[model samples]
Target chain A: MSGFCRLERDRSLATRVDGGGGVMTGALAPIALSLRGVTKRFGAIRALDGVDLEVPRGAVFGLVGPNGAGKTTTFGIACGYVRPDGGTVDLFGEGPFDPSKHRGRVAVLPQDAQLGRDIPLLDQLVYFARLQGLGKQEARSQAGWALELAGVTSRARARSRTLSHGMLKRVAIAQAFIGEAELVLLDEPTSGLDPVQAERIREHIVAQRHDRTVVVSSHNLNEIEAVCDHVAMIDHGRAVLAGTVAAITGKNEEVRITLAEGPVPLDMVKTALAGDSVDWDEASRTLVIRFVSRPGRGAEDVIGQALRTLLGHHARISQVVKGRSLERTYLESS
Target chain B: MIGPTPFRDMLLVAWFELKEMLRTRRALVVIALYLLGGLVASRVFVGVIGRLEDVAADMLQTTRTATPGALTRQVLHSDAYREALVRLFPNRNVADFLLGLPPIVLFFAWSSLAFVPFLIMMTAADTVTQEVQDRGIRFVVIRTGRVEFVLGKYLGQALLMSFVVLLTGFVYLAVAWRGLQGFEFWPTLDGILIFWPRIVVYGFAFVGLAGLCAMNARSAAVARALSFVGLTVSWVLGEMAYRWSDGIFGAAWTAIGFLVPFSHKAALWRPGVAGVLPECAVLVALGLVYLSVGLVMFRRKDL
Candidate 1:
């Protein structure tokens, strides 16, 4: 089996661990959403095949993939837009077939979903709020607050067709945040936005992460890395990597040492740390050391030894940084 | 907090659909067109009635000296009249009584019954297809049940068509009252009040069919085309069946004829409270069937 399949199988065993009571060390939160052996087909193409995923409550999970990776299909299944041909999907412990059971608790920001052209922005927002079970007066009030939160209060009365693409996206974001939904599924939330606007949306998502779970599916790996604490990377209809950003990226295995002066010698570092791989960039005066420790030895032990050796050699070290970047990890995994 | 009940959700969807219709200005345009059509039809009917009255007077002077009631019976029971009634209202003698009504009433009843379906098709053709094409249905479907969404759209279209039919009925009544000053107020008002509700029910049958078409079609243009084509095909087949009702294919043609709305046009002029009940039941059944099929298809369709 592929690595993702093995990970998925292991997750089922982990679910049986039951609140850190067995060999597992930490308490695992109850799953907010789960998919088991889900499969879908369109004509000859298999969109999703035997896919399994689990999202814990109170997590900012990122679903990352390249084009045609079934990210949008998975989102559609969760929101009850696309029906699966086999297996099952559960949201908040309810089957995907019945979203109304979790109404007002789940909201979706579908990528490129256009608002009704003739509907005023405020009216459209209010209508969505009312669909979440708010009364007319409360729906109107909350719509106003949602618009303000999305920073589109100035265009509240504008018809959706009259707004630009960026403005429409903001309106859709406001519509998703209405009723303070417990689980927000945002598919490509910042797919088409300027860097500044994308940053603002990222900050908004991070701010909202303290209370409710947010599942964001995006091709923007950098944005995913910046916002996500937990992530699952799907490729060609199967999840290739699924874990905390730190664990999946293997950020703990490497350390970066920045020297005060230029020309840190690679040979000196290589002789000092025998088994570790070291790369010295003479122009930047930085040494990147990759540690491959044995089981239970840990990267910290190796790093400590290297620190003492560098100090003994009288090397001027300015700063130490840890962990691999997510981009590199994503490229290696996919 | 509790979410909306299925019934409440359906109502909310209907309310939103109605608001969308108004916001898009389609509702106002449809209503104005229906009323204007009714006025123009009533005027043409008045001119036709005047010429027919003069012809009837000349025929009375030339005929044998018979009682007025006998003359009326002769005119209605003639072979030509019977054949015309059979062509319009198959397996029924109700048109005999319909023929005795005022010329203006007959014209209004026939014209409204004949044209209301097209009016409904025009108004409701984009009801579901527009949202699906624009991907706006994603927002509402997540919040409410699919069954409720279909029901709401169907109900909203039915309600709009009902309003249009009712307004046209009043316009016809006003035109008839002013043009035919000798006509009695209570009877003409009663005839209109009785006729328009049945027209509204018939209008709903078309609305339901249009909703089904819209749900399956890929775009607003396709929905309109499908509705138009479906109605035209059904109408042409119904005409053929009626025309060929006396041959070896008589039984099959007659059976197929009843499936078309045009086959029930005579029911619009049926007198008394219970006269249109059977036809109303059939129209309601058609509406239910269309709506049920639409809901089934929409529930399984990908959005």
Candidate 2:
């Protein structure tokens, strides 16, 4: 047992760092997972049609879609749980049909699986550990660590049926990290959780982004914006848009300057910041700027220069705000 | 990296099921009731014999001198006794009654066998429906292949059920052995001492049937109910078929009757009465086919 434990610990250390300990993969590797021309149908209803997406590794990816938009179906196909009627899901450059070969490579927090209600929470965690190929002793050890990470270690011996819904959700999320899979899939991890429990789950998820790839799904746009590095919005079974969160949100950043003392001429401000990239809203007493110099930089620099010009015009700025966040951009695009 | 196989995953699944079932008070309650029922029913049979002897003594003054065993033997030879025994132990021997016990005690095991199918349905329904209801099926499907997930659940639950059925059968067999000593209950009772094969067959049947029900049902309770209803209806239909054929279907209907495991045991008795074995080969073959179809259907299920 000692020798096996030492061996597993050594293996863990080796995987955690490469050579000089710099990330073996970049902070976010390009297109860790891809789904192309995916179509699925159940009898007459087409759940997904010509859907396309790419998720970068070592970053948080969010798949945001409404209840019947085929998001879960796509995720299931990716994990090899649901065979697709058409198209393909490629994970870590490997085809999804054969994803079972990547079993220990990814972990999933299924949407609503409470732990075994009849068994202790720790026992359920240990059961997951065994699924990841760990021996009994190793499984028990890993389950202990996982329970701590989930903040349910205190309830480890308690039967899962006795745990609150929030705790059960956390435990489900905790199982996703059990084997330290390179990629983790979390389906609605905080759906029924209280604010505090949701925050804890969010923090745990964010902390894992540095060490692994995560693909999460939720109906809440704010939660998606808060945790996801890349975002994919699906509506009515099609991928409306998908890219890095910054790339999508950065498309049209606007600097809004509100004057406290005097009403500044909107035309003058527009003229000063003028370029094909700039537009002004006179009704709101604001200057709308877009900096198109860089590929995704049409707005950032334009806003910066426009703010300076506003100060030059004695605009008596009351407030400056960065508008057109990803949420708004998504709403506009979709 | 060592990748896991469907078989290995199934072990983990079965192990969890075994743990969960063991902890569930419902399962414990069912098991306890079954054991309690068996013990009490057997003791009642033993007690009833003593009462019957007293009644016989009052009716016949000479019988007061006769031992309970002799009195019972004489009763068995009477025309009224033959008619009554025929109705009482329809599938058993009159020699069994002559040995001083009712046939219902020998076959009380049939009713208790419902627990196997019940547990199987409960386990299967909970497997996929629970995942869907909990919303975890979405993510779990991502880590493991659907085929592995479904097959793992099927095999795991089946293995656990096999253990349970075998354990219960052992207990029942022990009681039967103790109660049937010196009684010509049925010559085949000796051969039926080992029940592992029946457990395996019934386990697989229950697992497959329950898996199909789970795939069709959106909730755990619905799945279990459907499986139970399906079992009950099939057994009733099989019994009707048996009676309509004057039991002359030559084990064809009996083999079909095996679809409802316990019912098949009853239908198999007619062949035993004539000293010929019912064609269990067809029954086992049908069970395997049901299992195969279940596996295929589960592989394609949305969950």
Candidate 3:
């Protein structure tokens, strides 16, 4: 069991104590959620193959996958929405798929799910709160907090039918937070939103990242790029890439030297740096240099050599911009 | 914060359904129709009794000229008149005359019938269909378990349908109890106690029917139509078979009745002397079968 699963067990124990449902003391560790070698197959179609994932105590995780990549299947399995043909899931070191033990600690904003048209947004939140075992008044108060958490405090009283899709999305997010969940599963929290709404939702997830682990799946790579600290990309039920954002996207290094002079011809430089890569950007009058040397070779090594060559050509240098190395590696690898 | 228990989760799902039902105004309309239907049907029953009483009175007057006996007067008691007056309609042995009232009475019973399946559809319509449509189900890999989601959704729909069933059951019972001859209809405690339980049994049947239909379907429209068709077809088959072969199975007709919740409850109650089914055994069987199938399907589903 991972540390994430332990936390969920602790929360359940605490709840049982309060609910007078019999409490077990100090017997279980506090892990939020953990998965090991989970695999799912739909006849000939293998949706998730040998997938292992871990969500830490409090962090924002992003899942990026193309259509039919089993990202949703992974999500469903984690939340107990779907059963895996193989693998073990643990919530706070408790067995996976135990609705009786792990429900209050988990909240999910399912993709494209709309609330009942007749229910009020506030009522919907409160109802979810109640489901987490709060009394009516306590649930109502917590509902307000949930809406505020999702940044939709003003729309609490609005009828679900009257609200816009963006607002509805926010309500769904609010519901995810209603129980002060330790783990939040958000499926496309901002798919169809305008730029502003999308940003607001991203901000909400980020704000909550310090206390609650957020696992979000979205085709909107930009959203994941903006809010995720860790990311996993799936293609056809297998993980093509998985790691921290910096680790996955920062795999290679590139140094761009913007010069005050005209584009210095790199014919000789290209010939000399045979086995390496170099490109000159005319718009910025910058020469971008890329190589697969390694981490030990710093930007200073590339910069020093580039300058020496430029000086030999009597070229003037301006500012230098060294962007993400891993992004280049990811793109190339993919 | 409290951790979620199955009971709490069940309640949360039920609360959500109640809020949705109340907010939609459809619940209110259905309840109103039920009330109106119950009153009208009761009146029809009493009215038929009134006509029968008048006929009895005329017969007595005609017979008084020939045989001036006290037995006729004893049979025509004041309490009998009161029962007839209160009921406002005749209680006939024939099922058609009783069923001929407004859709409210005949239809409202099935209205809650509509709610259970519709609510189940509402809960699960988004299951695999919406996830595929929006490509959202992929996120579950990181935060929750797949089985948890399937079970959670199934439990949620079950909880919601149960609430609707109970509420509508109460409505049916309240109307039926009030419209009856105020305890005059059944003089024995066994009879009166059994009547309310029978109504409750009817409610359980609806819950099972709705849950099973909703679980089997992907769309709300399909769920509703399926439940409706299922109900009608089963009853038709049961009625035809029973008439043809003395209530024995006629080419799987009994199985058809099991498919239609209303028909099953009606048939179950057909053995009762007062047109009510003793539905304990049948209710338990239907509820368990439907709930189990629904849960199993939901757990295995992709969303």
TM-scores, one per candidate: 0.82, 0.75, 0.67
User: How many residue pairs clash in all the candidates, one count each?
Assistant: 1, 11, 65
| Local lDDT at B33 for model 2 | 61
Error of 2 at B261 (Å): 4.8
Interface RMSD per candidate: 5.9, 5.7, 6.1
- Estimate, for each residue in A162-245, the C-alpha lDDT of model 3 and write its tens digit: 877766776676677665466788888777777776776777678777777899998777668679888877776777777777
> Which candidate model has the greater TM-score, 1 or 3?
1
TM-score, cand. 3: 0.67
Off by over 4 Å in 2: A1-30, A41-46, A66-68, A81-83, A97-99, A251-259, A263-279, A294-314, A318-323, B1-4, B53-207, B212-215, B236-285
Best by DockQ: 1
Evaluation by DockQ, superior candidate among 1 and 2: 1
RMSD each, Å: 8.8, 7.2, 9.0
User: Which segments of candidate 1 are over 4 A away from where they belong?
Assistant: A1-29, A258-286, A290-321, B1-4, B25-31, B47-103, B177-180, B183-187, B240-258
Model 2 CAPRI quality: acceptable
**Top candidate by TM-score:** 1
Write candidate 1's Cα lDDT for B128-218 as tens digits: 8888887889999878778888888878878777777777777777776776535556766766666778888887777777776667887
Model 1's interface RMSD: 5.9
